[model samples]
Target: MCPEPSTSGVSPPVDAVTGIEAETDHENDAFSDYASDVSDTTSTTSSVRAYVYENGRRYHSYRPGQYLLPNDETEQDRLDMTHHVFSLTLNGDLCKTELDNPQSILDIGTGTGIWAMDIGDAYPSAEVIGTDLSPIQSEWVPPNVQFEVDDATLDWTFPENKFDFIHARTLAGAIQDWPDLVGKCYTHCKAGGQVEISEGRANFFCDDDTLDKSSKTWQWLAEFRKLSEPLGFDIAPRLPDILKAAGFEDVQLTQKHVPLGTWPKDPKLREIGRIFRVQFLEMAIEAYSLALFTRFGNWTSEEVQVLLAMVRTELKSNKIHLYTYTYLNDLKRKAESNDSNDHHSPEKRQNTLTSEAGNDDPGDEITNNLSQDSQFLAASTSGEETLPNLKNPLVSTPSKFLTDFQGRRRFLGPSSTWAYSRHVMGLIRKYLGQHQPLEIPLNTDGTAFALEFPSTKQPGTTITMQDLPSRDYAIYLINTVKFHVCQTYHLFEEQSFMQGFSKLYSEGPQPLNAENKLWYVQYFIVMAFGKALLMRGSSEVNPYGSEYISRAMELLPDVNGLYQDPITSVEICCGLSLYLQSVDHRNTAYVYVSEYLQFYRVLHELICCSLVSPFA
Candidate 1:
């Protein structure tokens, strides 16, 4: 929390709706009128526009909404709060010496102009300008931080080569032309300026599954996306390219995934995500309610009121799993560095039994276990009635099965990580001790592993079957992998050289092969499983799990040939006008950044595995 500043004689706090308080205004006639007109075909679009225009106009005058975010004081206050939080979480205070001095700053879509105001306050000598279209910003602000009402789509008004820092947050569905905005940013930014953008992927879902799909909560979201998409804004996928196109060098994009309620695997993040989500719900109700009602039409006052009530109730419920990815994209021109580019040698690569951090080597322990399992499997394979030469099917089955059985066994006295591990080991031991060879295909298939036969096939036909690992062993392996990864991750979370290694790996150069790719991906998956286990015990530790789990996210570029990291290429291809550098990173100071850094490294390795592969 930031120290409360003297509002200095600013009139008793304006009764503006920001966070939870914003809901009360649903009683306003404007919202009612907007809702009633939705079913009216000809008037719907116009009504919404009128409502938006009017709201924008009214907001310029009477600030009557509540700010629900706990950090809802002022934009500047939030900025200071965000920075301090980020510094402590990421250990940025320790790395503060590495950052350049502050000067010119830019706040994109500076709602309330708080972030810029606080930044200006924090760095009294720096010149800060907050840009947004709404005239709802505070009338009186710090002398150094100024607000400008301008559409970011227009060419930036700032001089070329001017700003030293730029920041933007929560402008989902607002900016239509990201390439143009980024280009303008590029044109106006000074040599080493940094720009950041943060956003949430808006989503709506009901906890009870009892809420009607036709209910107001669902309808508003459907219409909100409907109106927003046609206007040229994509809610979920276009962030990274926008930053790259803007000409910010050395762009770094990181994602903060916020879950709606306690259902999230991580408790701390669940709480934080829930808080933001509730705040977002109220803000969305106020900010977009009129637009929704005006666009969709025919919402009776009773229906509208009920929908509002439903949304709030759903937000407080654990069953609702809505979440938004808050992206923190940080970009800056390359600062002069004395460090030489790092290249790995085969000898060094072969010596990786010990981690890069020079820690206690777990390679012997892991390999020993794998070898023991393999030898036992090999012996069993020779005596199998029909199971083929494939690897241990018993050891592999349970883990994959549990992932797919989310609803089936969740209520059973389900064993998690270690229980699953014990099961696997138990089965392995059982198989090794079996006296007689199991039949090829038995009536009950009581054997641990089984094979399927080809019915009426031609000569030389082959049979195949899948193996099931013990649930206990599967759980243990996964959790143990995650634990080691956390240990491995500690080395990179704050260390500059480790970060450098990760950045380099993200750029390219690593082995590429189907087997190796799958191996690394398996390790990554285990890391995530491990995190879920940790989350069951200590909630705060769950964020660390999110960081690891995120590494397993599918990379479109790596999989579909449709994407590439921004830093690798300077220009857009396929005549695409807009470009994005990476995810934005401004308000992300409140998020778990260290875990994300670790996630990026594993993701990079997985990508490299594919990129350098002979098959590709």
Candidate 2:
């Protein structure tokens, strides 16, 4: 019933695998002996002249540099990485449609045309057409697959109801009007056909309390969103609504939490996190930011680079557990029939809409109770039903509480804090018992314990610690409490501790007083140790340590007048000692510490009326 694909004006399709191999060979042969051919390729052909070349990458000249990123080999690699990520997320399936034999498929905004080629190979009998703005797709492709240079936002010239399946993914930032795009897809898809939309949430989220509002990564995301607002591409949680509004039936939404780094305990998630860190964070962040920040936000390239560097540091840190939600929407077009349709009228359809939030797995049919004039109706059925709400027939009503795949909730129950404390205290006692024998008093939760041991600094003296939990126990308590409290809560704010500090240092300081001076001293102490923690387990020296220490030293004059107080003097000395111990400096650290002690003595004498206050 369908016409064969015409190869009249189009390039002949090459074997898909053979194309990939040829590209790989070209890269290896060209790059092995010399650098990549970064020379201008715009004049290679009249069609290639439509692209703008910059920084060894090609950009779309049709929009006059509207799209910030390049369509070069680097971007192609990142697109492949995204393909892997999507494949893993969907459990090796491209779409959730149950169609036995889809005749025609359309892929919108299909960069690199990899997905289309793969689908073409999988279904040799089907025709797959991949459309994009650039013509950077490989010359070789599957016989049934074809690539065309087309902007998805423009009016599509394809015949009505031509495709059996339509798919669009990762077009969040590229689309200006998503509702219009969905409508176009609905118009082109055949009756009883399916449309699948896949997109990741634009904002970042964290289940653990590790990532807070003040993090550098959060700031970067805030700035990115601000610049992206004018582009009209902020569609994540609202995707399902848009699909349903486009006259599609049987809309289903699935949400998954994708980690940003390799910090998850689960092996599968850990691998995904690693790929995201390397492919997205390290390689693609700059390409995504460079033009947007410069043109839209008026930020200098150097300033953007500095901000991105800080973001990279935060992303690499295991202490920050971050993830973003990826949403998949599956919808179907109604079959043509003579039966009266409930949602045929736009007015009634708009008025009778209902919203239902789903969990990770499929659940019940959310019903909307409305008047007789309302078009929305709830229908529950098995797999045979046209618009079945449940994904699996065996999945019944979901339990009120959320559970993991193993069906066990690994969270703190009632009295969990007490139990955790007891377990930690037991471990501390076992480790510390070998050092000395002493009476250790237990608090109500058995966390606070006191032990007398010879001080490492002052070997002969026995130091008694009271009302303090052991270091290991404290860590366990913090982790347990955070895991329980932050399981459901997600923080989304730009103003935070680090942002405040950045503003203070970048801008001139306010009128310094006693309180403000003490705050500066405390902040310096905290940051020095924070850097130490971030640089742990590294074989090489931490490149950030010297810069951080230098910045902290700039605040030294703020605390100059407080040298008369022994507690203030002791705090500064202790902070300096800890910082000296943290960094691995050959000679610069000793020089800095000696200069600090000399400055402290001079300030002490100035604060005191005479030099005989403490030194004399």
TM-score of each: 0.39, 0.49
Per-residue lDDT of 584 in model 1: 15
Per-residue alpha-carbon lDDT of candidate 1 for residues 235-277, written as tens digits (9 for 90 to 100): 3335454443333455554444444433444434533443344
Considering every candidate listed, which one attains the maximal lDDT?
2
- Cα lDDT for residue 352, candidate 2: 34
Q: Give the per-residue lDDT of model 2 (tens digit) for 1-616.
A: 0111122211111100110001122222311211110001122245643678754456776545545677765576567567756665554455545555576999987877778876765455578988876666655455578877777777678887799999899887788667667767877888889888888766555544455566677678768878776775557666766676557778776665566665665555654565566666645787778777887898988888899998876665555556655677777888873423334333344453333322322233211211111111121222233222322111122212224455432312222122333454655667787544335443222121121112332212211222222222222222322343334322111133234344453453545454455444434444445332322212122322343344445444424455444344445555555454333331333554476677677766665534423223
lDDT of 1: 0.38
| lDDT computed for candidate 2 | 0.53
| RMSD to truth, every model | 30.3, 24.1
Return the top candidate by TM-score. 2
Which portions of model 2 miss their true places by more than 4 Å? Answer: 1-45, 54-57, 212-214, 337-616
| lDDT of model 1 at position 234 | 39
